[model samples]
Target: VLAFTATGFVVAAFGQALGIDTLVVRNAGAIILCLVGIVLLIPRLQDGLSRIATPAAAWASRQQSALDDRAGLWGQALIGALLGIVWAPCVGPTLGAAVALAAEGKDLGEVALVMAAFGLGISTVLLVIAFAARGALARWRGRMMAAGGRGKIVLGGLLLIVGIFILTGVDRQLEAFLLDHLPDRVTEWSTAF
Candidate 1:
């Protein structure tokens, strides 16, 4: 995850410096490519993916639950990194600005800190969701499993839409809009470094 974040930050910074209007598009495209790579390696990910990518039709299949086991943090972290890379297109905008700033190629330590902070920000939200919404997610997972092939199709379609949104540069537009309308304090802080 750190390596992926660092590479993304560098790409964002380089794209900004070079006046690349298609940075988001290219990044999204890269994300799609990464997902393709993962899909191609499904044999390797089968065990981990099976738990997360539950078939919708089997929503009520009474599968064994392991949400609270907490026995595989390192393994989970590795899988999470792989998942992050595969889903980058859907959430690229989540760190677009921070990445752009890190890409400025300022101090190496500063860049590392900024990337770390970004990772923490992401992790904080996910942890909160995991803790606070476990029941809801489990229910949703059941529903997804019940939906089965249809559920999978819907997910695939959603991914396609996300891909299209990224390819169309919606994220960049949103980023620009936010930057343009940022509050004075945010603007000042963002410009400080």
Candidate 2:
């Protein structure tokens, strides 16, 4: 999550520095996200993606093994950080869009905050699953993988729907409405941050 947050911030900053039009970036990001959803929904596309990613994964595995043989705990940490840097962007479309949206404000702090919050949310869920459901997950691992396939489809459809919302500008309208209706204290707190 930390690595993701840092990468997200840099991406936002780079986009801003390039003077890219916000609407264009937002639309492009939405389209990319929708494409990712489509890829997820299609097994053939996933297989293709896997083939493309296999080399990278294999390299990472080898590096992990070498690190384990040499650098001990510190090497493991380094490899983990390297994986996070590489892995985050691949899995970051949802939060990437959020950070891109936040970038429209031209506020680096806001972008960082959004990325941090998103990372924290993901981390919390993963930690909870790792710690609280380890046994149950191990017992049901096979079943869970089957269910996970269905869950991926559902998630893909939802991403498609959200992409449409963002593209159609409904997301902005909803955000505006929420902001308009937010309590003064909430608004004030956010601004203060």
Provide the overall lDDT of each model, using Cα atoms, as 2-decimal numbers. 0.59, 0.77
lDDT of 2: 0.77
lDDT of each residue in 1-193, candidate 2, tens digit only: 7777787777667755767565786687689779988988999999999999999999978978998999999896776567657655554455556556665665777777877787788779988988989789789999999999999899889888778888998988987898999998988897563
| Per-prediction CA RMSD (Å) | 9.2, 4.9
lDDT of 1 by residue, 48-142 (tens): 66666677526533321232244357655655676656554444544455455555556655555655666667778988988998788777887
Off by over 4 Å in 1: 1-73, 87-90, 136-193
For model 1 the local lDDT of residue 182 reads: 86
lDDT at position 105, candidate 2? 67
TM-score of each model, paired residue for residue? 0.44, 0.65
User: Candidate 2 at residue 56, lDDT?
Assistant: 100
